[model samples]
Target: MELIKLGERTFCADGPFKVGVYILKEADGYSEVCIIDTGVDEAAAREIDEALVKAGFRVSLILNTHYHADHSGGNRYFIEKYGCKAYSQKINAAMISNYDICPSVVWGGNPVKEVLNNYFYAPPCEAYDISELEMPEGLSIIEIPGHCIEMFAVKTADEVYFLGDGVVSVDTLKGHKLIYVYDIDKQLESLELMKGLKGKVFVPYHGGITEDISKLAEANISVMKENIELILDICTTPKCLDDIISEVFDRYGYKLTMYKYAVEGGVIRAYVTYLYNKGELVAVKEDNYIRWKKA
Candidate 1:
């Protein structure tokens, strides 16, 4: 088990995954553990469990930084094994409770489809049996909704921020041939917030690690602008989400992957949604589809 000692009483699960789990050791032969995020599966749970045993800390609680599968996938297992409560932002709670696809990765033909699908259809809502956040707890929850709505970061003692997929390293994003979000502007706003942070360590979800978040934030913004320009240069006519995605990505010869399709739609919708909010675009809510056009 890889346990990284970060300052006093704080340990991070360093390599393989950058998810940070904080440990608070008490002098009277007791300890309190706050989990920032859970990794892919059971391996993560056991590894973390071992780390806690070594640190002599009791797993009192596990708080998901967000609902992304990489972050929240192991919630049930961890909570059950350790008898600890689990918490996430309200929106995330809704996602977990509703079993939304946003937090769970769905690749068609993946082996876990049946398991994931069954989990989705399981009895009543998934139990959210954990306490919410408070400043006195030494973790400040900042709501940054963009990449995923109801997104948040945890600021541990002395300005250590755990940005949950809010912003990512440009290079890491580029490798996927795309990044994702439902609203680019909101994502940009979220990134802007990261820039203004006083914290020295910026733990972005996908990026390995970053202390100079301002530079990373600015670079992400620049990429967004470039993508926007490239997209707009060709979207001369009014187009729907699917049409834009097929044209922009397909025309560019980029692999029209499942994640890419979602990203392209999200990027277009972000612009459209932003315009709608500003009264520049008009949106009419239909039963299953919402129509948007220049206001």
Candidate 2:
């Protein structure tokens, strides 16, 4: 399909990028265009350009909303083919560009889903060597470290906050009683920042967009706070990282070994860290296992 125009200079594409692309239509020609979030592979990359060609917009600069493979996967292809500059958050530069970062571990992140479900896919990206640039106008980023080390959201002029995964859409939130945010506290804080937003709409990449983001923010916060309390209650003894993880997952009726795999070790530690930071819990070093006692 051609451009799914959202505004005078903006458009969105599907399948590749999932939700779509944000096109800054070039006034000069096709060469001056700015695109935010290139979709998955070479095929998606080509379609983005082809659609631009059809719309008479030239591709010039490409900005990755974050370093996730799904968002920046096409950066290398775009820069190599179009000579467009590639950009991402300064913090994630090494992780996304290094060849050693095998992101496949992030999927089927829970062991329960890993055993019950066999859904898997190859890691679709290689290192993308983008000459980084600062974020552009109408695209301010706030560090949301829970989802990953360097997660952020891109806000547009339309009062639409293109939050990557800081929060899921309300539609997806409707059925699930518990939401699996790796860093529950930071995710909560991120949602807090979003709660203050005057923006009437939110466009998260994964589960589609939402309107009146304040409402979704409220629901997510309420449910998550309750989950945290429940997890704390279940912690009769301090267990190893994996044991705690498994315990928490099983409580939610989730198999820790399935669906998704890479739950952040540092972030998991951060969950306890958050509780400690909040003065609600205390951690004591035991000989073999760390004992966490609620204060």
Considering every candidate listed, which one attains the maximal TM-score? 1
- Model 2 lDDT, full chain set: 0.58
Kindly report the root-mean-square deviation of model 1 from the true structure over all alpha carbons: 4.9
User: lDDT score, residue 263, model 2?
Assistant: 40
Residue runs of model 1 more than 4 Å from their true location after superposition: 27-30, 100-136, 251-253, 262-268, 275-295
Q: Which TM-score value belongs to model 2?
A: 0.75
**Model 1, C-alpha of 287: deviation from truth (Å):** 20
Candidates' RMSD to native: 4.9, 4.9
lDDT of 2 by residue, 91-129 (tens): 455555652342433432333333221111223333333
User: What are the models' TM-scores?
Assistant: 0.78, 0.75
What tens-digit string does per-residue lDDT give for candidate 1 at 59-122?
7666676666667666666677768766777766767666545424332223233334332222
| Candidate 2 wrongly placed segments (more than 4 Å) | 1-3, 16-32, 47-50, 99-139, 142-145, 174-184, 258-261, 264-269
Candidate models: Cα lDDT each: 0.63, 0.58
